[model samples]
Target: MSQLPKASLKLFPCTIGGEINYSIPEGVKMEILECRNFIVENERTARRFLKALDRNFPLEETQMSLLNKHSREQEIPLMLKALEQGNDVGILSESGCPAVGDPGALVVAMAHKKGYQVKPFTGPSSFLLALMASGLNGQQFAFHGYLPVQENEKIKSLKYLENESKAKNQTQLFMETPYRNIKFLAFILKTLNPSTFLCVASNLSCEDEYVRTMTVQDWRKTELPDIHKKPTVFLLQS
Candidate 1:
């Protein structure tokens, strides 16, 4: 489902990905989708997977699925039912804020469809945090959500952004799946103009958080961090 900006509303999307690798509390049953590793009781592997995904590129979407059909549609009803039954169904993601930049468009779409009033609770966001700390012109930043996925087109897309970030001086922020964070960082180091500055914000809102900044050339000279190992966000400024 498409998410709007966060406010003080209890109704919101959760990046269950954020709670991945942790034990699922008893009596806190959820309709666990068969997307990640089966870890109904604990999801260590799923947690790490998503963490790495966050480290590289901002995920373009967070679609929940079941056999043949999607589950986010069902999720809205389930959450409503949960609230009725004195329980709250957490629309959790593998990591990070749900529906912020991840895949929760269908669920959010369904909630609004059924006339549910939504109020978002404040939580961590990769895009906003990166822009705030990048030391760039943040007043007019434009988050492109996620970069293009196709290989050739993705590079071209980034190149185009190079011009946009330079000409307009808007800080550009995005991410990929956690496992690809390192590779993506490598590409950013290799491609973006030398004078521009890049920031890699990793494991944001976590104990292991790391943010690295460097020019294109300096990035090439120094070894990059293993961002693929955890939640990471990439930011660029001219």
Candidate 2:
């Protein structure tokens, strides 16, 4: 009699800041060969990543389902069908680790509830990378994900986070859309206390990676980096 396959949900992390030349472990490549079903943020980018990992990856045979901010809650369960059939299912985010700040968390949570084993691969996380180099209190840090887009609300949120950091001596981390990087930096400089420390990590792990920590007052005097339309993480501590 043939042995039954052991089903598992694998979470694979990709390179951050859109740099694809970064190295992927041989073990991860070997594991990718075992999974024929993938839940990804973008089918095209996932296919490209797999192809980049291995030029001869079996793209035609593999199946990919979309899972992003717009994906419906009802459609998530369907993505796990392959696991029920005793096949390993993989989750891929557009960049960095899946389910960290991505929509893949929903499926991972469901997998756990349904009693499927979840295997996460080691990879770079932009936020953690920023914190490590930010020269701030790493022991106590919180990731706020993103700040408000509106001017008044955004300023209000910044003040609140700065106050919280001061009260707890904790590091507060946040990010903004690539296109709004410059404007957001300006807001941070203008709103936060001059004595507060701020760190801006941009295009992490890429060839043009930039990570700098400085006081809000110092930041005002120094020339700004060309972070426009580039991925960046901001850290502030008062």
User: What TM-score fits each model?
Assistant: 0.63, 0.95
Once superposed on the true structure, which residue ranges of model 2 sit more than 4 Å away at CA? 1-3, 18-23
User: What residue pairs clash in candidate 2, if any at all?
Assistant: none
Instruction: Write down the lDDT that model 1 would get.
Output: 0.56
How far does residue 99 in candidate 1 sit from its true spot (Å)? Answer: 2.0
lDDT of 2 by residue, 65-102 (tens): 99999998889889999987889999999988899988
Q: Which stretches of candidate 1 lie over 4 Å from their true place?
A: 1-9, 12-69, 72-90
